[model samples]
Target chain A: MSRPVSLPRWADLALLPVINVLVAFFVAGLVVLAIGEHPLEATRILLTGALGHGEGIGFTLYYTTNFIFSGLAVAVAFHAGLFNIGGEGQAMLGGIGAGVAALALGSLPGIVALPIAVLSAALFGAAWAAVPGWLQARRGSHVVITTIMFNFIASALLVYLLVDVFRPPTSMEPSSRIFGPGGKLPFIHELIPGLPKTPLNLSFVLALLAAALVYILIYRSRLGYAIRTVGANPTAARYGGISPERITIIAMAISGALAGLMATNEILGVQHRLINDFTGGYGFVGIAVALMGRGHPVGIILSALLFGVLYQGGTELAFDKPKITRDMIVVIQGLVILFAGALEFMFKPALARLIGGRG
Target chain B: MELIDTAIGVFASGLRLAIPLLCACLAGLYSERSGIVDIGLEGKMLAAAFGATVAALSTGSALAGLGVGIVVSVMLGLIHGFASISQRGNQIVSGMAINMLAVGLTALLGNAWFREGGRTPSLEGAARFQPIALPGAEALAGVPVIGPFYKSVVSGHPLPVYLALAAVPMTWFLLYRTRWGLRLRAVGENPAAVDTAGVSVSALRYSAVVMAGVLCGLGGTYLAVAQAAAFLPNMTAGKGFIALAALIFAKWRPVHALGACLLFGLLDAVAIRLQGVSLPGVGQVPVQAIQALPYVITVVLLAGFVGRAIPPKAVGIPYVKER
Candidate 1:
């Protein structure tokens, strides 16, 4: 299909990622074997638990919806050459935003409340990200370090808010009161009949729409060109009349907004109450998703879905095979990140030799 | 007078808490000064802490534990070097990978071995670094403020604290008062020039990273065997990042790093002290605000609202030879 056949586009785009994932699974299988579990049976269990039935698929999609937001968050920043590791913090802030919105507008109809909640989440997340972005763009501070610090700060802030300010007098838990009926998001089954009763909601469709918007913004817009240019080479981008600082801030804000959108899945779709640590490491997992996806929208969707499967499947595996605990999933995730990111080129030379020799 | 005594006690605790941070900051200083950004400092420290705890528990020897810690840390260091220096991969990604691997591996192994929900058994007596009193502590007990302060703050820490304190000056001497320091500095600032000067850039970076690992080992050992008796999951608890912040706040200087670590340590102590204290006018200050104080200050510092941090010029860049 390729004219000169240097390395087929399909191989570069699809084969390598699949191969890396396979390697990760292979190592994970060995780990399972070490723990006296059958690897082949484990795989079957993971897949079936994640995707075999309507209820399992619903849970998987619920998780996938969250990952899509975070993965896109990382990818947007990647396009501008900034590492937005603060997605965790930003998403937490977004949860707070959702809480505040529900509290303020709980008397309104669902149609009115949902949009306000979504807007609030995105705005709150963007504000959180903007500080680091401004520091990087205007003050020459490193975004990565500032964002990491912000994650801790965000956690602290959330704990204070939930415990001191928002905690219901009747409740002992460090979580806000449940949302009123008007503020609650409709489940997917309610929106469309005959589906399983699960946490899956309108947020999944929102995620898909957001993906489409991100694709258009990134691949077909002027700002996208400027972001890509700055990421590729700042000096050249500057010479070409794009302001690097402006692009950096804009890109980071967009990343943060995307990350903030993740709150709708947990706060609106599932829990309907703001709780501490609700993010549950999804922000960090997003980094792996972004890297595995090669920072592309399509790739990100696929990777996010893959991680969602892993999450649901891993839970099942742990429950079924108590010896293969949930921590084993983290080990497999780490292996995937290690191979896909740090050792990305380990197989490239061999592949090149094989292709070149064959041709 | 009572308030002053409380303050002194807090200072002592702060000093104790500062030891691990001091080691980590020095480790980071060496690695970054050699132009290799080592975000994996947290990962290395955690791995070392686990190794130290397990080894100390098994062998009944703190020294063996320290050796195990250092070896594990150095192995992580070598992995970072291979990824960043050899393969020319992204330093941040590699560092993050190390952190993830360390966290996942430690929990998995700990759960498999002890089954106490991913924590090592608490060490006792010989298995841990016990606090040692200086020779004159008893004699000076009768003296006033200075005596108690010295005895509590400076004299009775485990050996690792003293070693960590001593490491500051050693690091200073190595970075400023030696030929090796100059070459290391040159490599970070301009690897091309170092290469032109016939020194191998990769070798310098690898050495720096390995040195960082050793320092991280001491820090981790202090955490597990001295600071606490067992290795808890996420026991490092972002101290590695705090150390990085301290390094930046110190502008990558050894002596300044000591001050930075102490300041963060003091912040932590104050946060603990302020947790439940009620004030007359306002009310109790929330612990979360105090807990977040250091990071807020760091953000302000990074924003250049205070001082600027200019990293090494060649940092995060692979030194590629011209063909």
Candidate 2:
């Protein structure tokens, strides 16, 4: 089979994604117009609401932190030619791990309790992910289907644990008791007293560090080389003495570990307790983040920020224009995913031909 | 005799639940058998449910609603085909996109039109599918154990349930005993060979996908107009995914898919019944465990712990004709 001519570096890396984003926004604008709202005004309101003030910016950053963890989780797996759609389930299990750690170590200082929670989160996430990874690597079961099924199982498991096992006697709510004060991570506002109060916490810094580590691991390390090799051509990797199965398992484990950290941000940093559906589609949103970012650490960060804008800004848009609900934001996100992920190559061939003509 | 009666009642409900699942399972079967992996079955069902419900509300005709629902699902199927087949895009990504789009679009439109919080106005009597008594059901009910079984399990189901039952045999025949079915199966296994055989690979795939959409639409219509009176946000829940799992469990065979859907439906019925009941050896079986059974079983099956699952060789890979 013949392959289409590849686009130039500039078009592939920069121009195409920008064009896709524009198309997404254009479609979103049409929806807004259809609802009898001014598209330009809505865009202005969204930008201002998401980034205009310190509090909005802080909230944006806070959402971005969760996306980074889940995005990196997906990127790592994608590098091994694995689609780990189980981030939702992995993250849910991770919260239980963090919750257990916090409740057990609540009497200790935040410094002491925080590291334990983080450790448990990663451990739990990796373990949960490893099941499907092992199945895919050893038994040839498709990881995509397994991971998707795992998400539903994870939700049921979380509800069982929260309602049946972990809920405090006094509370009727389906959630565990609030963690002790020492287990709480300090919010950014506490560190910078002049800043506005937001859920933004030390986790943002942790996310940035994780992104850098992912960059080094994926682009700089020998393991990354092995992963890329397996993703690109497993037969060649097998010939080169690398076991594709082992790499698949290891890559998914790391991906799950990254996804697990999202629980730390929400449980330890924000919610202060284990709650149902606290992940709030963030894990699924990570798919869009990873796809739009092209699975690179830097790209993931940028796309994560873009989605943060959509989320925070969309909330404001819905509030300002009652006719347009928050679900419209999901529609816009879907459009972006469609253009950047599914229809990613739709425009490439045409663009290539145009570029060829220009030369 | 009393225990036997209760067993029949539970089995009846299981059959009722299996109707929607059978529709979706057949839908996924057609798509996958034609080399297109359709994870967006849930999305198509949701969109169809919303479309059907809204159309019924406006026109006051359940039949009209069913028609509109099929159109919407077919449109979604076309989008999936365009992205995965023509554009050579990632099939999974395309499916996810459709799912997300449906969730948002349905909610947005439902909220706007109904002003009832992302749900349609409930239909009364004739606006929805009412139970239809089979001919001589009353006469059959007086004939002992077999009578009650037929009365409870076969008679008085809405029209869609009967349609779903009829569809299984129709699907079986169409897939196994027809020339088009042969071409469809051949394309999924090796599109290049089909292309070499002078058949249009893309045309066959498109038709299979559209047929899948039509089946999903009927399933969605059943959910909204027959099982329930109105459309609610994400009313399909994970039934579409469960249907996909069923298709996989059945190894892409139409007849086996019917059995798989009924088995899942049975599991669901039992889970609902077992929620608070305490078993002899086990204390009240946790609701979560029963609810998680299907997924757990699917995973185990996929792991080759039970039966083997081998997808069509060319499934998920877009066909490209050699120059």
Please report the candidate that would top TM-score against the real structure: 2
DockQ metric for all predictions: 0.54, 0.79
- Give the Cα error of residue A10 in candidate 2, in Å: 0.7
Tens digit of per-residue lDDT, candidate 2, span B1-323: 89889888889988888888899999999999999999999999999999998888888888898999999999999999999988878899899889999999899878776777788889877779889888878888889888898887889898778888899999989988999999999999999999999999999999999999999999999999989899999899899989988888999999999999999898889888887799999888888897888888899999999988888888899888998
Q: What C-alpha lDDT values do all the predictions have?
A: 0.89, 0.90
What's model 1's lDDT at B111?
A: 78
Local error of candidate 1 at residue B24 (angstroms): 1.5
How many Å off is the CA of B135 in candidate 1?
0.9
For model 1, residues B183-259, the per-residue Cα lDDT tens digits are 99999999999999999999999999999999999999999998899999989998998999899889889999999
TM value for model 2 = 0.98
Error of 2 at B89 (Å): 0.9
Error of 2 at A35 (Å): 2.8
Candidate 1 chain A lDDT trough over 10 residues, lowest sum: A1-10
- Report clash pairs, candidate 1: none
lDDT of 1 by residue, A1-359 (tens): 11223467877877777787788779878888876789998888899999999999999999999999999999999999998989999999999998899877877898999999988999999989988998999888899999999999999999999999899999989999988876788899998899989899989999988888999998999999999999999999999999999999999999999999899899988888889989988888888999998988898899999999988888887778776677877777788877788877767666777877888
Q: Which consecutive 10 residues in model 1 chain B have the weakest lDDT in total?
A: B301-310
Candidate 2 lDDT over A1-359, as tens digits, reads 34767989999988998888788879988977876789999889889989999888998899899999999999999999998889999999899999999988988998889999988999999999999999999999999999999999999999999988999888999999889987788899999899999999998898999999999999999999999999999999999989999999999899999999999889999999999998888888889899889999999999999888888888887789776788887888789889988998777877998999999
